[model samples]
Target: MEQMNYSFSVCSSELDYDAYLAFLLENYAHIRLPYPFPVTLSFLASPLLMGEAAFLICNEDNQVIGAFSYIRGTGERQYEDRHIVQIQVACIAEEHRCTRLFLYALQYFTQYLAHGEEQVQEFRFFAPSDDSLRRLFSKISSLTASLETDSGPLDEYRASFSEWQSYASQFRQTALFNS
Candidate 1:
């Protein structure tokens, strides 16, 4: 992402439907996913599962290089919390991974999470329970659960905005940003 002229925008599900769909198709490798690519695509496309906030990270070429989306609230019907969101997806093109692009995009994301319409205070998410990714998030979040799935081991984590800030600050202090 160094010296790259990129743009950041939000995919309003109403107006930018195709944009988000295109990003998902272009980036997802169709491998190691808990559900089939088609199923996942449809689920993301559906209004019921679509996130309230979908951020697109694009390069100078107008191609989506990264995407981070979060649902408005935890999908639990009985548990109502407006300040908490559930991160649905965070994807960065393979070539752009571990680059300054993530660091930059995260700056925008955190700011919005902290002061956007909902003023999200905390978030929770799940990912493949690998040592690499898990270790990174675990440093700033509490591991709430580890579930065995056909695709792989899955882990759930929760973190506050402050905890997320601490995690993001590490990228600024070090040159290495793995996972």
Candidate 2:
């Protein structure tokens, strides 16, 4: 494999906002959102766009190869009031997937949460049913869950953060070796 080079940091105004959105759509074509979501243009230009969340970028040969977004849980924590890190999106160009790009990006994210005082005790991510998200999450120790309803439209499927992570980890490991 070619030498992979990159850096991780909070999304900044200097980056091309449109490219970020395009990157998401291209890498995650399987995701079907409810509507056409806006790109990163707002976040790049607006300070308010930066929330209790973070974005990571992988620059290789002066090109952006991967990006990820993580959010801090807002609700009360069950695990000793510890904050959790939730992954909103994790994308890497297909060409870079075989390398350690995505893995390193994730490592950077976890370290970022290891700051003083407010340490993130957990990490989470969710996946739609079709993907192996559930199985992957289960292996990582995330709690499995689903929508609770007697007879309703939204009562199809769901999984808790912990469950998702547990399963997703399995898939991640598989991907790491298979790649």
Candidate 3:
């Protein structure tokens, strides 16, 4: 029998921006993201180009199979809401979605590895009107959902960072063994 390995690292260079875009485009399609590629690119590109606030989950070969990035905020939040974290452009390749890699990536990324040493008080996750995203977001406890829907095109969810910590705990033993 053979074993698989996955590890995470901070996205450190804008030089790899194209590679990240390709990975995101593929995963976006696999997850059936409702938005068009260009539209999503407009948003994700900013964070990717920043070279921080983004992390990649890669295989032993260093191929990025999953990624998650933090929202850079705007106006006041950009300046003062440092403790509040909003994550966007989170995606895992479909083939890896049902595997242990899913839990590993989810747990690690939620820890805000890119900002692991920083203070984080709250976390926000967003799921568009897509089936795959909705299912992924369901891992959180029902009570954690601050808002379900706004009759808009996209769905927004807000929960404390502690809530994410609770959800991520389930895979601790398995993730430990794998990592």
Best by TM-score: 1
Please tell me which predicted candidate would have the highest lDDT against the true structure. 1
lDDT against the true structure, each candidate: 0.68, 0.48, 0.63
Which parts of model 2 are misplaced by more than 4 Å? 14-19, 26-50, 74-82, 134-143, 147-179
Write the number of the candidate with greater TM-score, choosing between 1 and 2: 1
User: Which sections of candidate 1 miss by over 4 Å?
Assistant: 13-15, 46-51, 169-179
Tens-digit lDDT track of model 1 for 103-151: 6666667766655556767878777767878776766688899988766
TM-score of 3: 0.73
Q: How well does candidate 2 match the true structure, expressed as C-alpha RMSD?
A: 7.7
Q: What is the lDDT of residue 106 in candidate 1?
A: 63
lDDT of 3 by residue, 1-179 (tens): 35768877767766456566778876665534356667667656767554446767788888888876775444455536767776767777766665477666667766544345667766665565656656766666232443334333576666677777777776653432221
Candidates in descending TM-score order: 1, 3, 2
lDDT of 2 at 118: 77
What lDDT tens digits, residue by residue, belong to model 2 across residues 1-179? 46656766566553544555556656655433222335333322222243544454656555667666655553455334346655556666666664355446544554455443475556655444434555544434444444433322111222344443343344343221111
TM-score winner between 1 and 3, please give it: 1
